[model samples]
Target: MFNGLSAFPLTPMNETGVDEQAFTRLVENLVLANVSSIGALGSTGSYAYLSRTERQRVAQIAVECAGEIPVMVSIGAVRTRDVLDLAEDAQQVGVKALLLPPMSYQKLTDEDVYSLYQAVTSNISVPLCVYDNPGTTHFEFNDELHGRIAHLPWVGSIKIPGVSVVPDEAKARVDRLRAVIPKHVTIGVSGDTLAATGLNAGCEAWYSVMGGLFPNTAKIMTDTALTGNAAEATRLSRRLEPLWALFRDCGGSLRVIATAAELRQFTTTPSLPLPLRTFTGETRQRIAAVIDELELS
Candidate 1:
């Protein structure tokens, strides 16, 4: 059922760039945390910035370190052809699954979305997990879209950002969607704050940026939540709330990734893609203070 925590680790980069050694360390650390699964080239891995060759190399490295744990590669792109190419390449990499979301405002109709999904599914043999973050795609996969896509044999999961302007509203939407979707297909929450809520609402899996920084603790919290211990899950989540706040307050995805790497001491030098700026000195201190206040190393 793809139950439990899946840490989406950042693909670390060093002086020479694409620090394979650091990446291996990152993988080994998460493996020791006993993560049920790991995703490569997802948002945290900076997939949108990496060249196709770089993505392939990182996917191979992730698969090598993944061991028996399932590894899923995010194969999304601005173009459908490129998305399918990545999926085909991922199938060759032996990933347990592949995820792709429509991008570049590419589709205006259900037919367009379905055709895009059909092409990727036809090309890839492994299970397909749909990445449904409208925050990036500028397109939301409504319930009808989800029901249509969920019927595909290879479509095994859906990953959606659990963020909302109003918590109650978010819960209502998730609950409604849960009622319609089949119980077999895994529903994964993307953010830490929504992990407990999503699970309580019937989500079976979660992928988190905070998990990448603190894999063991994330696993513990997720395991507790899945076992129906809402009290314990709430306690553990309170501890993570500060960090999640930092991720949100720090402003953008690049800052979140850079701040996480900096806090964890993953790499001395971290870089974010263009059209994004690095964290300021004050913001870094604020992030550090939150970590210290939470007593999280």
Candidate 2:
């Protein structure tokens, strides 16, 4: 489940509630594209903005739509009890794995994170993927902390945010991580722009935002990079430089992706939850141009 392209699709929504139809279409499209796995409620899925009932329903929809394709749902929340319940909810729907990011309002210590994993792992049956995305969570995990959590039962994979873009530095980063985690736990890289470098550096999986929406393109990049064709993989990533540039300039991928999705007619405007708006004006025009030029739609 952790290996290869694990696509994280958006949970598109509107004023009423979860846009079940659009969300289902996204999941069904990924299934058709045959991504290695479907990560339904990861950060790309706007997991943080959803209510419990909404999340549970999303999980059910993803599992149902994915069919034979493996489904991993994010169970990350600020509270341990909430995390536990979320994990159970995902498992009840027959999800293949769980992704947990150490989210906290108060700063989290290494011990706090380790204990949280220990508690959750003991209770859940599915494999757990450690989500080490500090940009949103505010909890930067040191290698020592990762080594500690990696030892717990059911620790299947570690989703590192992104490795160094430089080739040697990227390999060194993955090497250092591999030395700490158990051999059974695969190392997956997030951050779509750096995916080629990370994969060429030896990470086994990609927890990708782009893969969720544009599965065929992302999968080709993944398959190429994993096969050791460094030049071609780099070329593939370079071709998408326009999209990556948007990710860089816009603050993050969430809103930009939402805008792209809206342009493609996959979802309506206000695809994101309240208080967070998708791009408008010239920014939206630029994204639309990129989508057309790159044929992302």
- Report lDDT per candidate: 0.76, 0.92
For residues 1-297, write the lDDT of model 2, one tens digit per residue.
789999999899976899999898899889889999999999989899998999999999999999999999999999999999999999998999999999999999988999899999999999999999999999999999999899999999999988898999999999998999899999999999999999999999999998888899999999999889989999999999999999999998988888888887788887989888899999999999997898762
- Candidate 1 achieves a global lDDT of 0.76
User: Model 2 off-target regions past 4 Å?
Assistant: none
lDDT of 2: 0.92
Report the error of model 2 at residue 190, Å: 0.4
Off by over 4 Å in 1: 14-16, 105-107, 163-172, 252-254, 275-277
Q: In model 2, where is the ten-residue run with the lowest total lDDT?
A: 288-297
